[model samples]
Target: MTSLWQARSHLFNDRTAGDYHRRLAEGLRRVRDRISRVDRPFTGITPTQLAARIGRVDLDRPLGGAAAALDELEELYLRDAVYFHHPRYLAHLNCPVAIPALLGELLLSSINSSLDTWDQSAGATFIERRLIAWTAARIGFGRGADGVFTSGGTQSNLQALLLAREEAAHVSEPRVLTGAAGHFSVQKAAKLLGLGPESVVVVETGGDRRMRTDALAAELERYGGAVIAVVATAGTTDFGTIDPLPEIADQCALSGVRLHVDAAYGCGLLVSPTRRHLLDGIERADSVTVDYHKSFFQPVSCSALITRKGGDLRHSAFHADYLNPARVAAHLPDQVNKSIQTTRRFDALKLWLTLRIMGADAVGLLFDEVVERASQTWELLADDPRFEVAARSALSTVVFRFLPDEPELADQANRYARKALSASGAAVIAGTRVDGREFLKFTLLNPETTIEDVADVLDLIAEHAARYAALILEEPHVPA
Candidate 1:
């Protein structure tokens, strides 16, 4: 024990700088090699198989060296890990992260800055505040706008609804209005806020998957004084459809209801050179949620909840004598006052480095590329007779299903195709139920993915689906 204390090889400090540098370099090199060698998004390994491999590890014994540990990790984890950067990975909202943001991630992890207070984080507090102000300005908010970084879209939505709930404390019974296509997080947030299960009223959406202003107006009038807030989605997850923001804002204003725009997916449009007008009415929102990890190419857990009036964030504020005391709250820049979390990571640094190194336009262009790719994908699906598309998206998702010779077998065919494609590791895609029928979805967030890749995946899906349908048909019919 005395020798161990004297060595101090494990701790990160001035004395262990060399050890830290060497270990980190070894780890990075192994990751870089693995990424470069990856040819597919997944290895088709089942959960049980991976679990057995992990379970066999002897936790009591240590590798004792970085190289040996990395070698073990490569086989146990890196060899079968899903590579989101692969062009064939057309799955969820995950994006191929930016290199600059990776650098920020490295620096922040090493420094280990806690962003809850000024004394803990120092300059990091101001950096986060500046980024918040910059994002608010992009949303067309005035100097009174303010916000704090959050973990992701779910937390941002929760914080926004929390503020809205507190603002309507005077109302006897308050209802939250949102589109049928809005995110499920809104419902979860309502539950966490101690509201009744029926507190959230889902307004019907039109054929285009947008919340119909007429339906919204009717709901507003029906609820009348009970309606406390209207939550509008800038981008629906399944259809990638955006609600009619200008009309929704108008209705909310007239009804004296606070408007919270959940733009977690569509916030990328704020910097889109060619399509910023899609969010024209977002400036009128009382609060907005932005997820930088989704469309901005930043790493996971980088998101914010910006409010038009900075004071609205006071709902989340609670002073602790040991941390942010009430006496010095005015003088110190304590971010915990406006955040739902304490001891938050310095996530803002990732976006800060991304902006400083590559600028916002470059990130926007990457998103534009994916959006264009999705359009091309839609055209491909629309022209193909083997598939039936649900609806064209305004963003980077295309929802469609493979149609079999027998219409009744369409759902099974599509479902089998999705599972087969994923299991083969040739490609990865998402699935969802539309109108009570199964459909496959392609969320094109990787700019590197091309039309040819999508076309090849389509052919594979058709093959798998056709095989499944054929197998079913070959089964002998038994008399009931």
Candidate 2:
């Protein structure tokens, strides 16, 4: 007689349902325990050491069951995985996902619905379309506007630029224009579109870290009919600086240039009660990108590229008999017709569930709280004697450097401080170069992170910087 585990002909059958539930329950228990007692956000291991430890896992052999496999994962990955939910993990744009979104994840995985066509995903198609409509309305688009969920802001931007490229194909040698501090993907999109690296003309930024409309006007005139699209950043990655959208929109309108707003980072302001006004002229854009994962507290891959005119999406559509054929797709609204991706996951469900449970205002309040926290942190750092801070944050990032006695040692001290913080695993923050000098950044996305937590991290950074400075002074230089 066969064993009970081997008795089932296929997975997910009635016989295996109990086993699946058991595994899921066990996994959740482990996660709860880990989250409750996790003191460090990271394991603080060297890359080489981590690689050696992970190498011990044999992928060729079967782990026998989910219990065994999960145990191995816990040891090899979970213990070392960066936890964004932690109060001290202020490294990047990663946000702690809402509980409702996790429920959506579970439902999507269980159903495995692909939102390419109506047949493959009947209700899923309508669900995603409803979300698109909701988001487009939030952007103040007219009824003619349409959008599709994308993998992230990068893909959304690519789609927006691709549409712009197609619309401008009538003009010879059309070029893309964006702010100097715009996301790197705009340049990447230009290159990917077969426009050479030089095809993107960067407009200079002003003292306020916003796009200089005067310089933009000059460039537009210089390019004349050669400019296709003017890309405006709603929120910059490093500084969380929002470009002057109202001014940029006026310039784009006057120049007859198609405007594309990359609001991937600041799109959450749509619901943010305190800062939504910062997105003033985004409504006038011909196209826009929004990443729910970044600020909406949704899971990864929840982003959309929206366009004012529905016809603009035609550039990305392709028909095949096996998939979304033109005839069938015309009869019913198929998401694949508007997206660059086919067989896309039901990521919209996560946002849908999030909205249904938490309401949009609550989500906005969470973001508002974090932005407030960033303000508090900026105040603390600016008042502290150890840091030389930059301009006040427009969103939720604080960029500053360690103040050393010697100006020459400032860059090295900042870099060393960042490395030491990461190696110690007390907290993880980001670093960037500002005007050729290194600066540490606090990308505060976690609402749970208190001002006290930020102060402690700052203290650690100062201690580390001081130690490095002393070591550098101790080094004797040989006469050349």
Candidate 3:
């Protein structure tokens, strides 16, 4: 029993501090080696192949040491992992995290602090509150503004809608109105809130992919007093287009409807030296969702939901005797009361460290670089006859597709090109359907990505698309 207890030196404590230091150093070294050696965004390893490799590992048998465990992890994860840090990784909304944030991640993981209550987290709770206040101030919210960090924009949107539902409890039917191009989470939130399938009404968008204010006004009049909230998207997923916030705010104000802005993708503009005016009317939003992971170059799962009125957060509050009883609510700063999650990680540390070390302007400059690159990419696509570009984004996404001579073959060609590009592991891009037609997307979040990289990826896409089109043309045709 003494020997068995001695062998288990993995627990982190004063006695095992040396062991923890050694293990952590080894893990960081392995990760640094992998990041330095990664050449492409992906290895194109199929799910079946990787699954089989992972299945061979014996979970019951211990590797006995950190080095051996890391060796196994490299084969199972690090080696074939999608390297978002690579400049060619243009797919999705993932960003190459800031170094300061990475440093915070190390400390937060080691400390393992929970932000549920004052006693549990102490000074950590105040840090989170201070950060929330800073974000609210950037959005032009007053002293009554309050917010809580969340897992991501999805949870932020969910909580915002929950508050809106509670506020509209007097109505028999409450509807959520948003742009047709808004994030799908709004619909999901409505469903999760027990609002029926038809509770969400999508307002039509104009040629620029922004919600038409005329249509929104009409919808508001059509719904009469039943509309609960108007969700204005500051940045859309595909086009990165921002809705007409000023006009939307006007309509919502006149109709006495609560306004929620899902700026998950556009919140970076809050500190943007040049483009801050694009989100001019965002100050009028009753609630706003911001994803620091998406736009602030922080690690994953750093997001917050801010409200103009602090009391609105009570909609998600539930008291438990042992955790946070109502008797101590006024005396103690308990974060769990404002959050849907009970035991949440201290993700606020990452952003806190990021802001402390790099400052908001520095982070905004990184985003500005990417946005500039995206504009140049749009011009490249618009001038090239081989492709048809979508609306020019005010943010950092470009939606376009290869245009072949035969209109019917355009969809198949673009689809094949996206798959081939991913399979070849040259560069990564995203695909989406626009108006029932297939299209490719470039979500440029990496500041290191340049026009040269964009040009190269475009050439690769064109080559793959042309090859697919030719192959389709050569195939033997059959009469229907």
TM-score of each: 0.97, 0.96, 0.98
RMSD of 3: 1.9
Higher-ranked by TM-score: 2 or 3 = 3
Q: Rank the candidates by lDDT, best first.
A: 3, 1, 2
Top-scoring candidate (lDDT)? 3
Which rank order by TM-score, best down to worst? 3, 1, 2
lDDT of 2: 0.89
Candidate 1: list runs displaced more than 4 Å: 1-3, 476-480
- Among all windows of 10 consecutive residues in model 3, the one with the lowest summed lDDT is 471-480
Q: 2 or 3, which is superior by lDDT?
A: 3
Residues 261-362, candidate 2: write the lDDT tens digits: 999999989998788898999999999999999999999979999888988999998877888777887688777779988989999999999999999999
Ten-residue region with minimum lDDT total, candidate 2: 471-480
Q: How well is each residue in 1-480 modelled by candidate 1, as lDDT tens digits? A: 247874577899998999899999988998899898999999889999999999999988777777888889988999998888999998899999999999999999999999998889999999999999999999999999999999999999999999998999987778999999899999999999988889999999988889999999999999998888999999889988899999899999999999999999999998898988989999999999999999899999799999999999999988799888877677889798899999899999999999999999999899889999999999999999999998789999999999989887788888888888888999999999887889999999999998999999999999998888887788624110
